[model samples]
Target: MKNYFDFILPTPVLFGPGMAERLPTELRRRGLARALVVTDRGVREAGILNPLLAGLDAAGVTCCVWDGVVSNPDADSVREGIEVAKRNRPDALVAVGGGSTLDTAKAIAGCLAAGVAEVFALREVKDPRASLPVFCLPTTSGTGSEVSYWVVITDRRTHEKVSIGDPALSPTLAVVDPLLTLSLPPRLTLWTGLDALTHAVEAFLSTAASSLSDLLVKEAITLVVKSLSCAVDVGDNLEARGDMALASLLAGAAMQHVGLGLVHAMSHQVGGFYDVHHGLANAILLPHVLKFNAPECPDKMKTLDNLVEGEGFMEWLKRLYEKYALSGEKVEIKEEDIPTMAERARANVNAQTNPRKAEVQDIMELYRKSFKVVE
Candidate 1:
C-alpha cells in the first residue's frame, strides 16, 4: 500500500454493445481524415473489419489496411507497420483487433511520433512524444491493451520480452463493444477472462496499489468471478460478455496505474521465449504466483477469497483451471531454459511491483510448478 499514488485514465473510453460502430464518428469528430486501420489477418479474415471499414468509408475517412500484425508481435512487425504508416501517411491509427494488433498500432504510432526508425529505439529517446491519436477497438477482452499505456514487444535479436512504458503509448480513445467479442472462441474467452482476473488480482496486490486502483480491481475481480464462466460456457451471453468487457477495461486501467506482479514477469519471459499466447501464459502461471505472494499479502488474498465466494482464493483458482482444462495444454519447457527465463523474469519490469520479492530461484520453482516438471 503506497501512501501516495497517481491514477491515470488518459484514454477516453466508449463502452457498450454497439460502441464499435461509433468509431468512425469518434474519428471524424476528432477531425481525423486519413486513418490507417491496424489489425491482424485473422480479424480481417473473420470479416470483423467489414462493417468498420464501411463505416469509415461512409464517414469519408480514407482508410488503408495494415493487417500484418501477428500474435506476440515482435520488433519486425512494428517496423513493417511503420512502413505501412509511411506509405499511407495517416493522421490517425485505428487498431481493430486483439491485444497484439492494438500493441503494434501503439508501437507504430509511438515510433513515428518520436521520429525513431525502430520500435525499441523509442525506449532510449529523451522526452518521448505522444502517439498519433490511436483509436482502439479490441476484439478480445484481455490484455486491456485498449486502455494500457505499456507495450510489450519481443526482441528478435535477444529473444527477450521487453516492455516500453510511457504515457505516450496510451491510445487516444478506446471503443469497447462486447458484441465484437461474441465471435471469440470459448478457449480464448476462457484464457482472456482468466487474464483479466489475473490483472485484477495482481493489481490489487501490487505494492503501488492506491485507493482508486483497489476499487477498480476489486470490482474487476468480482465481475470475473461472477461472469467469466458464463461467458466461456455460453459465448453468446451478451450480459456475461458485457461484464467481462467491463472487467477487462477496469483491470487494465487499474494495472496500468498500479502495475502487475510475478505472474506477468514470468509470463512475459514465457511468451517471448516460446511464442506462447500471452493470455494463456498468464493464466497458467497466475495461481502459482499468487500462492507465492499470499504470505506477503494475506489480507488482500482473503479479500480476493471473499470476492470468489470464500472458496479459498487458490482453491477457487485451481477449480477454474480444472474446469478449463488449462493444465492439459501441450506447452513444453526444457530444463536448461528455466535458468535463463528466471533471470529474465527477475529483470522484468513487472517484477518490481510484486508484493512478494521473487528471487531467481523462486521464479524457477514457479515455472516448474506451472509446467508440472519433476524438480
Candidate 2:
C-alpha cells in the first residue's frame, strides 16, 4: 500500500436541497455580522438572490449588493467590488451566482484584505496573509470556485485572463444547494458539467496528483459521467443535480491539491481574447485536449474509461456533448488564430503542471482539432 499523506478540506461544506437556507447560521457561527453580497445582474433577475437575501436578513446581517460582475470577471469589476466592500466595511463577503461571481468576490476579499487597488499586484502564492472570510452559494454546478483557492480575473487593458492562487482565497464556507441550480438552462448545464469533468480529468492526470486526490478525482469523473446528461436533459431531476453538485465539489477539492492541465490553460486564452463563457470554452476544447494528453496518460484515461463504460472515454464524452446540444455550438476559432492562441496557452502557468510536456506544435494541433469542423 502507498504511504498516506496529509489531506485536509478546510472549507466547511453544506450540501443537499434547501441547504442554502442555513447560510444565516453558518455566518453567525463565524461571527460575521455584516456582509457584502456579490453577484451578476442576470442572477438577480433570475430570482436566485431572493433566498440568499432572506437568509441574511433573517440572520440580522447587514449587506450591500453589487451586481455589476460580468462573464470572465475583469480587474475593473474587482476594483469596483473592492470599493463597495470598503464602503460597506463588511465583516465578510457572500458570493451568490456562478464561478465568475464567486471569483469576483474572492478578488474583492483578497484585495480589500491586502489594501490594494491593483488586482494584479497581490501575489497569488507569495502573500501569506489571509483574506477576509468569504461564504459562497453557487447557483451553477460547475467551476467549483466555491471551494477552490484560485481566482481567475481578466486584465481589462491587456486582455489577459490571469489565474491567481492563494490559500487565503479559499472560502470559509460553501453552501451547495442543488435546488439553487434547478433553473439553469440546458446549454449552461452541459457547459458547466464539461468544465467539472475537465477539472476531474486534468487533476487526476496531473503530475502533482496524490493518491487521495486521485480517489476524489475518480469519484468526480464517475459522477459526472453518470449524471451530467440527466442534469442537462431533465432539468427537474433533483437527483442528477445533486450528483453534479457533489461531482463539482469533489473536483474542486481535487484541484486544490492536484491542480489542472491543458484544457484550462487553453480555455483561458479563449476567454481573454473573446470574452467567451469559461465553461463553454472548456467544453469546446475538452475532447481535443484529452486526445493530446492521452499518450502521456493513457493509464489514467484507461481508469477514466473504466469509470464511464470501459475503453471509449472520448466517444462517451462526444455523446454527452451531442446529447446536450454542445457538440454543434458555434465558436469563433479559426485555423489562422491557432498560432497565437497556442502561444498564449503554452504561456499559461497551468500548462507547466500538465503530466505531459506539451510543445507549441502540440498546442497548435489541439487548436486545429478545436476549430469548428462541421461534419
Candidate 3:
C-alpha cells in the first residue's frame, strides 16, 4: 500500500438490455441538442447505426455521422474528425463502435474543445478542457474506452501509439447493452475478452494496485475466466455477454485507478507498428511478460494461479489462447526491429509501475519469445 495515491473514475455508466434506448434521455439530461455520432463504416453497415439514429430522432435530436474511422485508428484520422467537429460544432458526441472509434472521438472532442492545433497537442498540456459532453454505447466488450479516461491514437508516419490521458477526456455517460455486442464475430469476441483478462491481471500485479483496485481486479478476472468462452461460443447469449461487459468495465476501471505494466507497455508498440488488433497483441505477449514479472509479485501471481483450475498461471494463459482459437493469428516481427521496439516500449508511461523494473534487453527478450505461438 502506498502512503499517497490519486483515484478517480469519472464516467456515469448504465448496464443492461436496451440501455441505448435511454441514450436520448442521457442527452436530454445534459441539454444536448446537436450531436455527433462517431463510429466506423462496419458499425454503420451492421445496422447498429440505425437504432442510435432512430433513438436520437425519436427525441427530436439531430446528429451528424463521422463514419470514416479505420481499424488501428491513426492521428491523421483524428485530425480529420476534429475538422468535421470544427464545421458542425456539435454540442455532444456519441461514440458507437469499438476502441478505435471511441479513442478517435475522444481526441477529436478534446482537440476541438481546447482549440489545439494538433490532436497530439492535447498530450503535452497538463490541463485539458473538454468543451463538449460525450456519450458512448459500446458495440464491443473490450477496450473499455467508454469508461476510461485515456485514448491511444496511432501516428501514421511514426508507427507509434500516442496515449493521451486526462480527467477531461472521460465520457460524460456510458451505456452498455449486451444486445449491442451480439453481432460480434468470434475472432473479435476472443481477442477483446483476452484483452479484458490481460487488463485485470496486469493491473493486479502493478505496484500501484490498491485495496479498491484489487477488489475490482479479482472480480474482473473471475468474470472473464467464467464467462468469456460462453460469450464467444454463443455470440448472442445475453448472460454471457452481460458478464463479459461488466468484467471489461471493471478491468478498465481498475487500470484507470492503478495503471497497467509490461504487458501493455510492450503490446502498444507491437499494435502500432504491425496494425495488429490491440487485444490480440496483448494476449500473445501476456504469458511471457507475466512470467518474467512473476517473481516480483508472488502473492498476486498465486491469486491469479488459483483462478485457473490447476497449477501454472502462465500455462493457463497460454492454454486460454488455444481454447479460444486465438493462437493461430500471426504477426510478423523482424529481428532487426527488436532493438527499436524495445527502446520505445521501455519508454512507455506505465513501464515504471511494472512490479519488476524492466530494461530494454528484457523487452527484447519478451518480444522474441512471443514471435511465434504453438497450439
Candidate 4:
C-alpha cells in the first residue's frame, strides 16, 4: 500500500431499479448515435435486453446486435466481435449481460481502438483506447466489468485467461439496474454473488490496498454477507438484489485501484484451463488462499472475521461456500495439470498484489488443497 497512490473511476454509473431504461439517454448525451449491442444468447433470450434496446430505438439510436459472447470469453470470440464492429461502423458499443458480455465488449473496444486484429495483441500496445464509447448494462451482480478497466479473456492455445488492464478500456457509462438480475437463476445468482464477495475479499487483502480501497471493500464485504443469501435463495428479493449489485460495483472499483490477490490469481488459471465458472472457481479457491495467507496477514484476516461476525474468517467463508455449492461438486482439474496451472497462477497479473508471495510450489499446494475438498 502506497501513501502516494492514485485512484481513477472516470466512468459514471447510473444505478437503480429502472436505470437500464436510461442507457439511450446516456448514449445520446455523449453524442453517440449508432450502436453495436454486445451480449450472449442467454441475456437476449431472457429478454433482459428488450428494455434497453427499445429505449435505444425510441431515442433514434441506430443499432446492430451481436449476441456471440460466451462464458469465459475467448480470443476467437473477440475477433468475431471485431469483424461485427467493422461491418456495423457503430459510434458506440453497448454491452447488455453478465461479466462475460461486458468483458467481451471491452476486448472488442480495445482491439478496435488499437487498430489491431486480435484481442491479445492489444495487450502489447503501450496505450490502448477504445475507438468508440462503450456502454455497460450489467445483468449480473458480479465480475464488476461494467466499471472496472479490466478484461479477462481466455487464450485457446495457451489455456491462459489473460487480464488486460488499461484506463481507456473503462466503459464510458455503466447502467447498473439490479432489476435486470432478478431473472438470474438460483445457480447463477449464487455463483455471481460469491464472485462479488471474492472480489471484495481479495481487494481487501491485496498488498496494494490503500485507505480508500480498504474503506470501499469493507462496505462491499458487509453487503455481500448481508445480501448474497437472500438474493440467491429468494431470487426476486429486490432489496437483496440491489445490495449485491452495489457490493459488486464497489468491490470492482476498489480492486481497480489496488488490484486483487491469490484467489483471483489462482481462479483465472482454473477458468482458463477447465472452462470453470470464474466465480465458482474463486469461491472454491478463496478459503484455501485465505488459509495460505492468514499467517502472513493475520490482521487483515481478523478484520474480515470481525466484519462477517465469524469465529474465524475461514470458517465463515467455508460455511457460505458450502451452503450454495453443488453437492459433491469438484473442480475440473487433474493432478497432472496442477504444474501448468500453478505456473500460470504464478504469472497471473493479480498475483503481483497478493500480500503473501506465492511460488509455484505453494500455488500447487493450494490447488491440491482446494481440489481435494470434494474428494
Model 3: per-residue Cα lDDT at residue 224: 86
* TM-scores of all predicted structures: 0.97, 0.94, 0.95, 0.96
Q: How does candidate 1 score on lDDT?
A: 0.89
Candidate 4 residues lying further than 4 Å off, grouped into runs, are: 326-329, 372-375
Better of 2 and 4 by lDDT: 4
Better of 1 and 2 by lDDT: 1
The top-ranked prediction according to TM-score is 1
lDDT of 1 by residue, 1-375 (tens): 775877768999999998988888998998899999999998998898999999999999999998999898998999999999998899999998888999999999889989887888988988777658899999898889999988889997777888998987889999999999998989989888888988999999999999889999999988988899999999999999999999999999999988899999998888887788888898888877887998999899888878877587788778888887887245777788899999999988899999999999999989988874533
lDDT assessment of candidate 2: 0.84
Q: Candidate 3, which segments miss by more than 4 Å at Cα? A: 310-312, 372-375
lDDT of each: 0.89, 0.84, 0.85, 0.88
- Of candidate 2, the 10-residue stretch with the lowest lDDT total is 1-10
Against the true structure, candidate 2 reaches a TM-score of 0.94
Error of 1 at 148 (Å): 1.3
* Model 4: per-residue Cα lDDT over 190-290, one tens digit each: 88988998899889888889889999999999998888889988999999999999999999999899888888988888888779898888888877788
Model 2 pairs in collision:
none
Q: Which candidate do you rate higher for TM-score, 1 or 4?
A: 1
lDDT of 3 by residue, 1-375 (tens): 553667777998998988889998889877888899999998889999898798898897899999978888887788888888888879998999998998888888788778886888887777788788888788998888899889998887887888989999998888988889999998899889888888898888888888888888899988987888899899989999999999888999889878899989888888777788998898888888888998888888888888877666677666767776555247777777788889999999878779999899989888888875222
Poorest lDDT segment (10 consecutive residues) of candidate 3: 320-329
